[model samples]
Each structure stands twice: as C-alpha cells, then as structure tokens.
Target: MTTAPIRLGTRRSALAMAQSSQVARALERVSGRSVELVQIVSEGDASRASLSQLGGTGVFATRLRDALRADECDLLVHSLKDLPTADAPGLLLAATPERADARDVVLTRDGTALADLAPGATVGTGSPRRIAQVRGENPGVEVRDLRGNVDSRMRRVRDGELDAIVLAAAGLSRLGAEIDLVAEPRDLAAWPAAAGQGSLAVETRADADAELLETLRALDDPRTRFAVIVERAILAGVEAGCHAPVGVHAVIDDDELRVRAAVYGAQPGDEVVVDRAEPLAQEYIRPQGSGKGADAASRVAHERASGIGALVAGLLLDRGAAELISPSTAS
Candidate 1:
C-alpha cells in the first residue's frame, strides 16, 4: 500500500528553503515517505518594519504553526532561536536536529576582524546583543540597525554601503556565503550566541500522525537537544525575547553540560552581567543495553538543564541583570 506525501511547511526565504529542504530529505530518508514543501509566508518575512515592532520572537514560526494547526501542513521547520519560549497551544516541539556552528561572524569589505575594525566604523546588525557587545568591546564603533535577507545584508558589506555586518556563522555556512572573520564559539567569553542559535526545531501538531512522529523521534539528536534546552532554559528564566540584548550558549564539556549567559542593558555602552551555570551531568540515566534509552537521556538532560538554567538566571538577576536590561524591573 502507498502512503500520502508528508507536507513540510517552510518560508520562501533562501535560508529558510535551504534548511527546510534538508529537513524534507531527512524525513524521506528516515521514513521512506515522500515529502512536499508547502510555502507559508510569515508576517516577519512580509513586513519591512523592525522585528520588535512586528512582535518579537516567534514571528517567523507563527504563521507556519498556524498552517500546521489549520491542517495546511503536517509539520514546520524553524531556527530554534526564532522560536519563543512560550508554549504553543496544540503544538509539540517534537525534535531538534544536530546543530551547526553557533558563532557570530563579522563580514567586512577588507576582511577585517572585529578587533581590527576602525574606530567609529559603521557596523550593521539589528541584534541588541551584538550592539552591546560591539560597544563593550570597542566603544568607538557605531552599530546600525540592519534588516534584510542574508544576501541583501552581505551586499552592504561588498558594496561598501557599510563597513561591516555581524551575522550568525551557521546561517552563513548554510547559505554557503563566503565569510572570512568569524568569532568562533570557543571565544564565548567575548561573543556568546543567542539561545538555540544553530539548532533547528521540528514542530508538529500535538495530534500529529503517529508514523510521522516516530520519524521525527528518529531524527532527534540528544546532545543538540540538551544543549539548546540549557540555552533556552536560561533565556526563559530571564524572561528575554529574541530581540533582547541577551546571549546564552551551552556546550558539553567532558561529562557535563555548561551554560554561559550574558545580559546587556539598553545602552550599548552599559556594563553587562555575564554568568554561568555549574556543569551538570550530560545524561541523567545510565547507559544500558544497545543505547535505546536516548529519549530517557534527553528527558534527564532537560530536567538538569532546566535546574541549572534557573539557578544561573537567579544568580544573574541578583547581580543586577534584570535592572540592567530593564530599569523598571522590580528589585
């Protein structure tokens, strides 16, 4: 008997298409089921206004999720960072595939690194975190709010419309754009990434097809899942949005997962609160049998990650992170 093709919802942007195509191929490979792309135009993609004005966080994922709920598509793919921490009713964040490089890259016309950029240089980026970090690092450089697709942003650097632009290394890699100066993940003390920056979220309706759900579970990556879990937990704990001048990066060190968080106030030149969580065990469940306990390990990782995240957040708040970001934050 033949089965109907699974519909994977995606945005029409080049980056979105590239990522969604990857998910489609993975699903077909694991499930042996045909897949089709259903383009869903997101409000974020349609609007020319700032992301905050258009409603921060989840703007890109909202319409696709609406499509999934309306049965217009079977599932949707999203950049995990674009997903808001708030739970979506009737939707399950089913899986997070393996992550890519989670670093910020500075693209310049002269192939200059962030450290070498000239004083008063005009840098392009709409991210508050990047703005604050740039100012913190080099108080002279000017960061302008930039908005556009990957190619459009890159054009500014090449055409000399701007001296430089900061972008996600994972996005540049996925788009296959040539970038010379990347702030590596190893330099997290100076440039932590946005929570879930390099991860992909596979979301489906809560009442999704059982076979499809099984296929999604097969695509889950425990390490990636847990790493983003830690990162996102920190974000949620701080009550921050994608546009918030907050950065969180989580990584596995030996047998433990370590989460680093950075929060900046509204002013680009203001001080930042940088703190980390105690390294927690990578897996809560002991490995046994042929390693089929991956799901159980992920659950344990989530729990531990959450606990560590809450602890770290409380520490930062005590250190004045809340007041730094929002002057009106209750004491």
Candidate 2:
C-alpha cells in the first residue's frame, strides 16, 4: 500500500509560511522524507475586515487545527501568540522550537525613538497591548487599528498611510521585511510583547504521529522552549493573554528564569501594572506523561509561573495600575 506523506497545515500569511518552512526543513533533516506545506485559509485571513469586529482570539488558529483533526494534514505550525490558551481536544502542542526576539519594535519615518516620535503623530497597530503602551508613553499620539502581513503593514508607513506602526520584531525578521526601528527592541520592561510573540508551536494529533513527532522534536531548542512555556503559563492565568492587552517577556538568566508581563485595562491608554516572576531555570522542559497525563515540567512551570504572576499583578495594582482593568471584554 502507498503511504500518506506528512502534510503540514499552515496559514497563508507571509510570516506563517516563513515559520512553517523551518519546520519543513527540520522534518526533512530528521526523517529524510519530503515535507509539504498545505496552505489552510484560516478564519483570521477570511475575516480580514477587522480583528476588533471578529469574535475573538481563536480565529487565526482554529482552521489550521481543524485540518489536523480531520486528518487532512498530519501537522500544523502556528505563532505561539496566536494560539488560544484553551487547549484543543485530541490535539497536542508537541514541540516549540527555539524562541525569537519576543519584543515589539516601533517603526517610524524619521527614525526617531518611540519617545521621540513627534507628538500627535499617528501610530498604527491592532494590538491593544502595543496601543496601550504607546498611548501611555505619548498621550497625544494617535493609535490606529492596522492589520496585514509585514509587507502590507510596512507599506502603510512607506506610502504614508500611517506615520508609524508598531509590530513584533520577530514577525518582521522572519518575513525578511526588517526595517528601521523607531525604538529599541526589548522585553517586558521596555516594551512587553504580545504574550506569544516570537515563538512557534507545532501541533499534532493526540496519538503523536510516531515518526513525525520524533523527527520534529529534534528541532526543539531547550532555552527558547522553556522561556515560552513560562511565558504561556503566565498567559494562561490571564485568560487568553489577548483579552487584557496582556504582554509577556521572559528570558533564561543564571539558570534562573525571570519573567514579566503586563495587564492593561480599557482606559483610553494608560500604564498597566507590569509584573515579574522568577521560576527556576531548568535547562529543558519535557513533559512526563503516562498515556495522557500532564507533563512534569509543564506542571512545575505552570504553577510557579501563575503564582508569581499573581504576585506581580498585585504589586502592580498597588503601584497605581488598578485603573487599567476593563469593565467588560472589549470586542
């Protein structure tokens, strides 16, 4: 009987295809088998009219995931940030490769720093997190809702559709559309990134397509993997990090992990309390599951990350960040 080839379901966005290529190359290296990318038109792409009008976070991820469950594709690739915190039935986040720069970059025409962007200058971004932070920094600046791949977004600034736009450095770098940075790219303290920015997730069926799963794991890098786990855990506590304009930045330091995230309320734009946590930095994270059981490293990281997140949240609340909470989920 002929064998079915490994089909990798991915979104049609430039960055999504770009990230999927890495997975394809790795699978080839390990399995010595050809890997094919299946472009899945995700809901996010179809509903490009505006993200704010869409129901919520899952639009970008659900469709590709559906393809995997339907056996139309053997696996899928996703931006860790775009994935919903709520787990999918019969699906697994099998592997997360090394992370990228989990920070936001402020791009502008004059090449001025974020703080230097001319007052009242309009900044383009669809992210609540970036918009809140940007407005907090410059109350007079305008925050516009922008959606599209790196090229489309960048062209806005080039063609003067916008004066400046804020975007994830990782997205730009992966799409090979790097541009002049109006502000330095840094972590949570400097500029908190949308929860899962700069990270990638590889999803497979619950049964773990034996050969495919093993081959993909070879691409997993310990440092970035652990960092994202902690980042995602912190995100979980916040309920789909996107809802609150939440952003997280994490790193491995001295065998100890220092994590930080922000929670902003629905104010016109204000400083949300940014919090920090330190989970022990074990070199790598491997789940110890016995036939559907939870992972050992994930359990440890999840509990520790949330506890620290709560502490950080409390700390920030006390520091005049109580005003950032939203009255109801802003659509």
Candidate 3:
C-alpha cells in the first residue's frame, strides 16, 4: 500500500527551497514515501526590518512552527541557526542531518581580501555577530546594516553600493550559486560562527507517529546533533537571543568535544571568549540508534553535552559575557 506524502514546510527563499528539497529527497529514500514541499513565507522573509528589530530569535521560525503545530505540514525544515534556543510548545526538533561548512566567508567585488580593502570600505551584513567580527578585524571599515536574499545582497557589491559582504558558505554551496567574486573563507579558530550554523533542523509535532519518528530519526547524524546541542546550550545558558552578538562553534574530535564561544560588546575589540574541551561520554563516541540500550545511551550523552555547555557558559559569564550581550546592544 502506498502511504501519503510527507508535507515538509519551508520558507520560499532560494536557499530554503534548495535545502528543503534535499531533505525531501532524503526522506523519500529513507521512508519509501513521497514528500511534498510547502512554501511558507515567514515574518523574517516578509519584513524589511533588520533581524534585531524583528526580535531576532524566532522571526524566521515562528510561522513555520505554527503551521506544524496546526497540522498544516507534517514536518518543517529550518536553517538551524535561525531557530530559537527555547523549545516551542508541542514541537520536537526531530533531526539534524550531517552539517555543511560552518564558517562565514567574505565576498568582495574586486578580488580583494577583507584586510586589503581600502580604509572606510563599506561592509554589509544583517547579523550583529558579523558586524562585531568585521569591526574587530578592521575597525577602519564602515559596517552597514543590510537585509535581503543572497542574490540581492551580492548585487549590492556588484553595483558598488558596498565593498564587501559576509555570508554563510553553506547557503552558497546548497544553492549552487556561481559566485564570480573573490570569496575568502574565515578561519573558524578566530572567527567562530553562530550556534548551529550550517546545519538543517527538521522539526515535527511532539505527537507524531512512532513509525514517522523512527523514519525521521534515520536522518539524524549523532555527531552533528551533539555539536549543535552543545553550541545552542551555551546560547541558552547566556540568555542571549539568536540576534545577539554571540558566536559559538563546537566540534567533536576522537573522544573529545571542543567548543569556542564569544560574546561581543557594542564596541570593537571588546569581547568575552571561552574555549573549552571535554572528553565525550563513551556512548557518544560510539555509534548510536540500535535499540532501547542505545536510546538510553543517547540520553546520557545528551546530558553530559549539556552540562559541558553550561560549564563553558558559566566561564564566559564570569568574564562579563552577560554585560556584553544585552538585548539593547544586539544591533
């Protein structure tokens, strides 16, 4: 018997559609059920205001999440970084596929590196984190507020309205957009990305069927899920919204998970940073998802990961991260 297709809700932007289509195909392969993409325009997509002005954290996710809760869609795909850390009522983030590159890249009109850009060069980005990072790297450059789809933002550089722009490398790769400009990759060691950056979040209602949940679980990459959990835990611990100037990156190496977090002040060169690593729980290092025993192991691993994240967040707060990342200072 043929099953009904899974309706996956996603934003209508080019990047969103591309990534959601990938998830749809993957769901089809794993569940042997067809999937349909439902185009949903979020407030973030419809608004002209900056992310900070739109309240940052849930602007991109709230509407789509509402659709899932109301049974308008069976599942939803979200750019993980755009999702708020707080859990939505009656919703579960079902899976996070293997991550793409999590680093931000600098795109320029004339093949000039960010550092080589002339003094007073105008750099455009809508993210507070990128604004602080750009200022920290080159205080002389003029950082301007910008919002739009990827193509429109790139057009600003082409039209000589801005000298450079910062964007996530994953979006460009997913869209397969041919960028003719010089794209310089930022070093994650020094320039950490937003929590859960470059990851896709698949969410569904909490009351989803056991079979469907299992099918979605087939898409989860334990390592990717663990990393993002830790990173987002730090974000939550600090009580900073997604729009705050906070950057967190986490990676698992062998038996250890290492994280780097930064909270930037409104002024350039004023920031609090925390770098920490912990040995992963044995269950986490081993492969997961076999049976009840594996499920128990997964729970234990998640607890340990969250504890480590809290520890790092405490360290940052001790060093004044809270003061630097106040809501009023987000922009």
The candidate 1 region of ten consecutive residues with least summed lDDT is 282-291
Please write out the lDDT profile of model 3 over residues 62-160, one tens digit for every residue.
899989988999999999998888889999988899999999999998788887888999999988899999999888899999999889999999999
TM-score of each: 0.91, 0.86, 0.97
Candidate 1 lDDT by residue in tens digits, 1-331: 3389999999999999999999899999988889999999999999988775776677788888889999999999999998888789999988888999888877777667676788988998887778888777767788888999988887887777788888888887788865543332327656788889989999999998677777888777777877787777777877777768888888876776667788887566565555553655534423322234755665666787678777777877778777676522210
For residues 241-277, write the lDDT of model 2, one tens digit per residue.
Answer: 3545777777777656676766665554545545454
| lDDT for each candidate structure | 0.78, 0.71, 0.90
**Higher-lDDT candidate among 1 and 3?**
3
For candidate 3, the per-residue lDDT at 169 reads 97
Better candidate by TM-score, 2 or 3: 3
| TM-score for candidate 3, residues paired by index | 0.97
In angstroms, how far off is 242's CA in candidate 3?
A: 0.8
Question: What's model 1's lDDT at 154?
Answer: 77
